[model samples]
Target: MASLSHLNQQLLSTNTLPFTPLNSTPSISPPTIGFRSKSFGRPIVASADVSRRVVYVHAVTSDDEWGPDRDVPYAGVAVAVEEKPVETETDKLKKALVDSFYGTDRGLKASSETRAEIVELISQLEAKNPTPAPTDALTLLNGKWILVYTSFAGLFPLLSSGTLPLVKVEEISQTIDSEAFTVQNSVRFAGPLTTTSISTNAKFEVRSPKRVQIKFDEGIIGTPQLTDSLEIPENVEFLGQRIDLTPFKGILTSVQNTASSVVRTISNQPPLKFPISNNKAQSWLLTTYLDEELRISRGDGGGVFVLIKEGSSLLTNQRN
Candidate 1:
């Protein structure tokens, strides 16, 4: 049994080839039980080594009724056996990824109007606007206790329920005081989350608005974690739309262009933002440096940038 298993493994490891069996012609006389040939041509390259039986033939000839020697064919039949191929890590990973996203309940998209409507609805619920304020962090939430966590528990359900539009989010941790804002770790969201989403666990730090260095504590919350001394901007846009700039630290990632070149930085950062008030509209502002125009597509699919850039301003139709 072990020998057969090893043989099967060897056959499976090799590349595949076609198998054709040749039957005996009607005109050829069958050899007697005692009759045997002295020589066999290359052992007829049988497809299998099973059942080493004895046989006799009057003559062996190349079945060539055609032109060139290269086109000549050898005619004979014996047995055939096949083995299964072994899988590698890369193949497994590929299969896993394909099964995870393709043709599954884990993926979907909204129309432009649908996306805009949903964003507006979320804004209304959060009482915010879709417009982005300047990139200042201090003036907005100077004395708010921004609570941040490192989990995506509630957000994924809100998205899959069709009550929300997926905005490509990029989260960075910074300590904002009455000074300035600094970027810590940045993760660009690629796809919508499956119920079995991956955990974005990493240590990072954000520059406080006042430029004061603040450290994020995993066990502590709501005790004046990081103080921002700078003046917070009235509005802040995130992922090209409006969102609530709260003082909570949690997982920060967007479901936009998964290939955006935002890398992870800052070893001690938290996922939190503290706007002055939750009453005002908050949005996500995506910064770019493309010399040419940066176009954004409607809510078609991933990486669909429908926003057009005219000079220094960006233009997008409210609908369709």
Candidate 2:
């Protein structure tokens, strides 16, 4: 009687062994030799003749490699060979939070389950790794972030009925020695009867690593001019008020200045005059949930904001 290991090697070397595709039914040929063992019940061997006597064998191959070779059982063999990565609880929680905001439009409210999951994940993540020092805050918050979800009630009114508007936000970034921070926002409203874009710039202060105060010193709010392919309606209302773009034509226009005082205010050092306003500055507490990807923040008035990093394609696709 031939050893099972030797028989397996012979079967593999000779390409004549039957192999069924994965998840396919195995065709059974008449067995020419029946090898019976005390350990492994019955082994089927296919050959040209079926009138052979049964051979009892005492030796068996290693248990881990192959099973009693009948007609190559494809279903169980394929699954055991391929390995899958083990997902951790933290990973699952983070993925759930990302899925809640990914591809979601501005001003959309998250579901209750999503909100709970995000809160739990943020709590767990922060507990494991404390917030970085105040000096390290600017490095993480310097890039452009696209609005994903906001708990602020005011933003919901910006969306008319069932239309998704485009909201792009440039953050207020500052170094430790930097005294001022600037934020630029552009929101495009496309309705059935009107299409308009409102852009604004605000100067702010970073009090600490977790806190920022934004002052709306200067801004330009109006409807942008449309191209030949697009036209604005006769009447347009944004944020529950009628919009007049004529007065905002030169409101926030940038001008070159050689003055040293102007250079101190802007981070990019572009010489421009920014007039201070009497309006009070609002404070916001930032909580970064994912590095360079997602952030959750709350205003002094208890409104929450979720921001996601935007790619260059998002800016290019915006309507002028």
Leading candidate by lDDT:
2
Q: Report every candidate's CA lDDT.
A: 0.27, 0.47
lDDT of 1 by residue, 155-268 (tens): 345334433454332221222233433222222332233111122222223332112232322222111111112223445788898756443222222322221222222213
The regions of model 1 sitting more than 4 angstroms off are 1-90, 103-155, 158-320
TM-score of each: 0.16, 0.46
Superposed by TM-score, candidate 2 places the C-alpha of residue 157 at a distance from the truth, in angstroms, of 1.6
Q: Which window of ten consecutive residues has the lowest lDDT sum in model 1?
A: 142-151
lDDT of 2: 0.47
